[model samples]
Target: MAAAAPAGDDAVAVDVAGVVKSFPGVEALKGIDARILRGRLTGLVGPDGAGKTTLMRLMAGLMAPDAGTIRLAGVDVSHDRDRVAPSIGYMPQRFGLYEDLSVIENLRLYARLRGIAPRRAQPVFERLLGFTRLGPFTSRLAGRLSGGMKQKLGLACALMGTPGVLLLDEPGVGVDPVSRQDLWRMVEALTGEGMAVVWSTAYLDEAERCETVLLLNEGRLEYDGPPAGLTARLHDRSFRLAGPRRDRRQVLSEALGLPGVSDGVIQGDAVRLVLREGGTPDLLAPFAAETGARVEAVTPRFEDAFIDLLGGGPGGTSRLAERMDPVRLETEVTVSCRHLTRRFGTFTATEDVSFEVSRGEIFGLLGPNGAGKSTTFKMLCGLLRPSAGAAEVAGLDLRRATSEAKRQLGYMAQKFSLYGLLSVRQNLEFSAGVYGLEGRVRRARVEEMIETFQLGRHLTGAPGDLPLGYRQRLALACALMHRPPVLFLDEPTSGVDPITRREFWTHINGLVRKGVTVMVTTHFMDEAEYCDRVALMYRSKLIALDTPDALKARVVTRDLPEPTMEDAFIGLIEAHDADREAGA
Candidate 1:
């Protein structure tokens, strides 16, 4: 085991030493040692199955470590959770909020659970509502709130008793950018007020904002330090290449094949690449000249360093991509929405949404929570009836030929829709049967999916038992079992690691090369770069429509750094909101 950095009287909130935890067939954590200091935010960052949640649970006293000692505020509380419970607050990934209760009602309930008297809880609840910007929605039912609002409410509930330490597990996984900003602002204020916070997040960008970061891989700690120090190691090792937009795949393939190149991704009209140690600009000159692409050195971000530290390389060939039989349809318009609108009673979920997806195109719907992206998606998939207008899939009207249109495509919901009780192979077999496959064909398809997704060993394992990455793979495999022409992916990579995300997109790109149309909705702004075009939605309306580069150009200026998709997205939404207010 490596020697952990000395805590050195820095007001350590939690001290974990030589901790090891195990499940029936897995060692969840192995010899972990770290010190979380008060008044500082510590980011727990790693790939799926890296034991982030397990570590958090241990610190929260929800679970005991099989070995080693955990000290909470200088007191050993590894087995005495009752002694530590009063000083610790834990907000799990799926926070427990009463759906039937209003926001303020839920807060009062949690306060009561914590044994706070009404006299004291009222002031705290009011302050929390203001802090979370949820004061306006105090009367709204928790279940009716958007994903971001629910997370804020959860955080407020966790803070009811003013615990000295806070542990958040992937709190921003599916949250929109604006809400993410709000959440971080609140967290920073808490840390400023001398609260120790340990946050686990899949987004490396979020980790970059932390005062300290703990990097883990497969249950072992890899690095413990400031985010800047980790990113500094990759200085001069990262570069951006700009070339013909259509040559993205070719450039990525060639770049990955280059010596010393570690990993690369499509980044909105450019490819961001990370090179191994001792890699030089001269090494890339040949490829640059061949592709007529311009290469420029760029500062590496926290994500680049994280991927490099994990030894992530170019994604291997995707077997799933190989088995994807391209769509043979002769139509140019694969998906079309003409002023599609949906309403739930008096509430308009989506309105006047119009867009067309071309064959083999990757179309993305980008928006904030409650921005009607999912409602639009459901309309296109024929799951919901549009209050107005029409949509077509594979030239079949969604309303008139709903069954036929659905039969021509595959749909994966925002949540993993697979049966938790069924084995991996069983889910695949069931999916094949739903698509009307039988006999030897069903068996062959299931086996092919297992082999393609590398789920051979987990054939008998339940889907819910798999890691986040593997579960995503299984979901995608099941969605493609029948080889549909169009695929709908709803937040397909939520809570997944960067490595797995890269690998998943590699397969998607390959399938696109073979002419498959994909309509995807995602919260990860970086993933928007992979789309041929993206539509930005705000308050049940399409606010902007264009390629990622064009949308970004709307916000980019000489005085500011190059705008990311998130920046552009926020800018567009804010502008639209301002316009609506002015019109009103």
Candidate 2:
């Protein structure tokens, strides 16, 4: 913070000049310079370990930069932190909300921390509760709220002082489409009212919505301007090639190898491609000719531009595909749930949930947080004992042979659930031992995973100390040490960067081709496209189960004839809620 503003049109909320920050082993920021404006939205967009969080913390005065200065609303944070503290609101990745406290209680606690009296805080509290639509659940404990509600509460707490500059770091992480949309609208409205908002996110789509974008990567600023500056680079380079679902994956694999095809991914029944500078629409003809697929040029998205900036996504090849053994199972259906129910005392988490997954298929479990997706997932993983009915894994009854059923699959929890104290190598060894691998077999698999996931350099470091992407790699490796026939991934790419996400899916698609079955839960609706079929849960019930295309078809209307996965998700949930209200 400096000494007060220069006045009217030149109102700089936060000004950074030649800022540099370094940690023990890595330089987090390098000579960064930018000017944040009042009443404007500035998005901090970058990959994992690219200094988004570091920048947010530095601006919040949580830490002083090794070099340079950050002036907040005309006051220097490094020199006058106490004086400027009340002018800024900061929410880190994990917002500090007490699990045992009620929604209203958390807000009051924050107001007290900000030194606001109850009489003065009441009007602000009322406005926030009404704005976030959390008034009815004021008495609900923070721990009992859904992921979306928790985020809303976090934002409300941050705004307790009604600060001039608001910094939100990945507030939408682990939040579903409907909730993410709501969060975006809330932040946008804040910017409209003269609050300088800096929103950091792993999702590129969110960045594209910002009025101004500050793109950082590896301690350096790549671009600082409107999002259009990046998307314009990939102009006329993006295209969609549509074909039979069976042929698209194969065609995408082949298309990636073609001259000038920089990036390609399986999106619904088509392969979305991003071409290089010299690449042209003519390059897609060869792949389209054989499958009789239709090709049309599509506008490039911020993701396409982002991957291009990162030197393109990983190649569509998987080492696991070359090494992992084939699926060997007794039955075609590897997982089955028949009238499954789970209850915590009198409250039902999941009620009469049922589903089946065939061998080698990619089945998706999708829903908003606390919508029974996790309840159903836990029952399938044998982590929870169902209140009624039964399930089977690899032809083994979960109720009768829980241990045997557990042995048939590998589980990667949402948070990765790794032993943070153990070194990478130690974690791998421990995981192998848990799966009952012998000496030589265990050693070979450990080394194999290290090499496959490029974890050779970080062998001695604790998995928790690594970046979010590397930690994800180690988690997946630990889970797959025994090479189980079935894999259960719970929101595996929730906060991962787009580049790493592509690489993760490359391994997944490769495994599926070799006959390994997969059941995944994800908040990113785009990820639902990877599944063969999706089971959507809402308020402890399975409301829709079908292929991704079919689910989108259900929500089609004249206004939204071409609905995205996100569109289908929110639409179905709304229609279901409307029906429930009508019946009630």
Candidate 3:
């Protein structure tokens, strides 16, 4: 907002002092104070219901704080909202783009809403289409575009008038790695032009890119500094260890309980353990004997720091069935597909796709949005009939034994897909009924799941009323009501906080140990390492398939010591594209 200010020109872009907002039964946001400096990218990082979204909305002038003052570039938003509205571009967690409209139409509509002249927006739109690589899809309906493309278009529309301040809430949630890279590049370019950007995200890797970060927890500021400052907090303590699969969890748990171990987490094939204040060499020998694991030191990353900060919340439940024989399942080939193809009119969703998932294995299906992972998932679950090809789940043909196949698989869709209107207990009861569970058995199973996930405290509340983490737990409960042997999870952890994601996977690993085969799709690259085997999908085809380490090995051209899964994913995709172009 335009206002008379002190003569000094370098004022804070957005400032909040003692802000508080409350709902009926909860204090959503406690008193909070923070400042976003001019021409820099500031990140809002925290777990679900930490009030990151609320703070962003308050600063964007979308809501009135119960008790506080918020100033944007020296002007108070509460008192001068109308004047400041045009200067701030806000993108909520779920952006609103007309599904029926074309990309061009959506851009034009936003331009008109921002009061930009048609002539002036033309060049801007051209640049946007070029930057997003959406030139060929300009005429396609928004609903037909992939998730990543829609996000890019949303950004293009928000930047129509080139607002001074930009607020993005979880902009990269379901976006693929390459598209995410493009989006961050665009953001970096904008910040170079002196635009203040406030980005909120669930992925810690995304937060690492911010110039400065404000780590919020339950409406309170925990840490505020540059990105490097957060990483510096975990300097000498982090260590990595490698051992047998069955001993991994046992080793981590025993290590955590040791006198010298402050924290221990399983990362890929190793455990990243932080030493306690008075830890000594004598502690290691007894701890190794207790867990029967071989330990070694390694470099610590941001994930280790995050787990340490969350303290003792949820993790390591996966050790439940690891002590038992993991390969004693009823079915040998849990799921098998041959030349699977699905078509909607002339468009091929998945063409000649083939893959196999073994019993008691965690298999990952990695892909960009619109790469047909969901389509293939639906076909495997018997929700959709493939146009051609044959598939069998748990030894039953999907087409011939639809109902029988459904009984052998549990599916968690992209959306939590639980009824928001139904309470947690009500949803569980309904799900049990669908699986043909009777009154007594249904109640028993429901109670067991509730206790296992620690949901007794909120079972009476509506599923929608619970936070993101609780809702995910509830959905998984419903899916596993019948104890299906194979589970299909489509972006199961999308838009969830890092801590919650870690907890969710901890439960998932527990299931895998009990001989439940899992086929999952996800956007977070770090998660790829957790799966036993991973398949990278592009343009409805499987580009690469192997263990996470093997996939990374395919892309190793240099002797870089710490090449992460993200690096390998991008590198493989690039080489695949290059080979495709040469063949074409």
Candidate 4:
């Protein structure tokens, strides 16, 4: 097999041909071929467990391909990594940043490691600091920087020696949208300077911005073309349906059930739907009339095409019970925070934050990285003590009756928190037992969860060995084993693909229908639209709270187009900052 030709006259920075890589029980890549070029951005994209990482490692010369050749700057990297090392800069998803070192110190250290003289390194440092907009923070400890800043610093270090090819793996996963735009600007600038960039991301929107894309799934290359070509496949097959605000979920549920509707998700106050082949607009007319929903033809996005390529629609019946066992609606507020304030010495993580979540509501907490959203979530979950103010979970004070409050909720941390070494079954059993289940009860609960989450096949497999989507399923299963009324999810779908994210949210919607209360934190603005109401936090203060539609409306002005959730979020933050500055 031969690698594809580079676009136009641009030189190929890395050429991969018939690359195959296998782990113990899986073939991560099978006969993969791609030609990444200088002066261009090649998007390496796919769903979870699509072998993107394996291919990246192989290209980076960090791992040997089972079979095939990888050429870096025309040099055989597999056989001569040392020769190719200086020409390639690989930044893994989790960049190795020394927490104790200052930004400039880390850059200088990388320069020294690359055998660059101090005189040569000084100019590189100055250039990187200016490029990354980190000059003011050069003296700050790497650990103290925000998620976006850290990513910039990591990129700066990777470019210390001005490598010809840069491979960045999901650098925008947890960063806010504003910072994400900045990162992309920096990468685009690098490409302008004749450096080739291969960015591996699950974000379809981000992928669409690339010059060319390599779409892989289950170790096989699915599509190798420009993003416009990919999206063009689904032309005129997408539509947006808008109705009464309260009918949003109903609209989504009904749209998914439509015979022609391939896939549907709540986008702001409307439901965006993709139609199956041979499906027509008339097919949706009946539902539209019944629900008072107006349908309009819309342009298909990159996500719509990606989901279509990955087998048009969702699968299997929802595992949740058809109906929720009735809970007494004696109290309206399921979760409440009163003047929640948390301080670490002289720094206030969160200040005077207050909110109330009614029963059966999906409340979203939105903020940029390090905006103190996590601190508020921890306080509400009783994981951290608040310096002042009060919080109650399910009517129980988190500070006072912590145990009682805990029993009323389930929590899924931002990162994978289950024991990686434990088997899927073991983790479920452990969670059940922790919630006080014993003997036959624990066994029954674990089995039920296994069946519910479709984990029977991987029951004996270690959690770490499963795909990211499956790992998420296992984590959710563990969190819900005891069936707590209130659930707290911290960045549940951070790095997952659109398909897996939709699936995860499907289960959450099912649980919500079953009368569960959910509080979630996420950087994905689209996910915020699914919430009944969202609270925007900035600088440790609550800046905006409203339904998604209302929030967007608030942000719309002469300067901005009709706002998406991301625009609304940025608008709210900027407004708050402006107000604070004016007061100061």
Candidate 3 residue runs with Cα over 4 Å from true position: 1-11, 245-265, 275-294, 318-329, 457-461
lDDT of 4 by residue, 1-584 (tens): 11233566348788899999999878889899889888889999998889999888888999999899999867889899999898888899889999999988899899999899987878788888999999999899999999999999989888877888889998888898878988999998888878889999988888989999999999899999999999998887899887744467666876798778888888877888999877888988888888778889988888888888887656323565343464444577999999999999999999999999998899999998888998999999999999999999888888789999898898998878999778888898889989999999788888887877678989898998887778888888888878888999998988888888887888787777777899999999889989999998888888888999999998888988678888888888888889889999
Worst 10 residues of 4 by lDDT: 1-10
lDDT of each: 0.89, 0.88, 0.80, 0.86
- TM match of model 2 to true structure: 0.96
How far does residue 245 in candidate 1 sit from its true spot (Å)? Answer: 6.7
How close is every model to the real structure, measured as TM-score? 0.97, 0.96, 0.93, 0.95
> If both were scored by lDDT, which would come out higher, candidate 1 or candidate 3?
1
Q: Residues 1-584, candidate 2, lDDT per residue (tens digit)?
A: 11233467567899998999999889999999998988888989898899999999999999999999999867889889999999999999988999999999999999999999988988889999988889999999999999999999999998888898999999889999888888988987887777889999888888888988999999999999999988999989999987644555566667777878888888877889999887888887777777688788988998899888888878788887769878888899999999999999999999998888999889999998888887788889999999998999899998889998888899999866999889999999999999999889989999999998889989999987888889999999988898889999999988888988988888888888888899999998888888889999998999999999899999999999989899999999999999999999
lDDT of 4 at 283: 89
lDDT of 1: 0.89
lDDT for 433 in candidate 3 is: 93
Candidates, ranked, lDDT: 1, 2, 4, 3
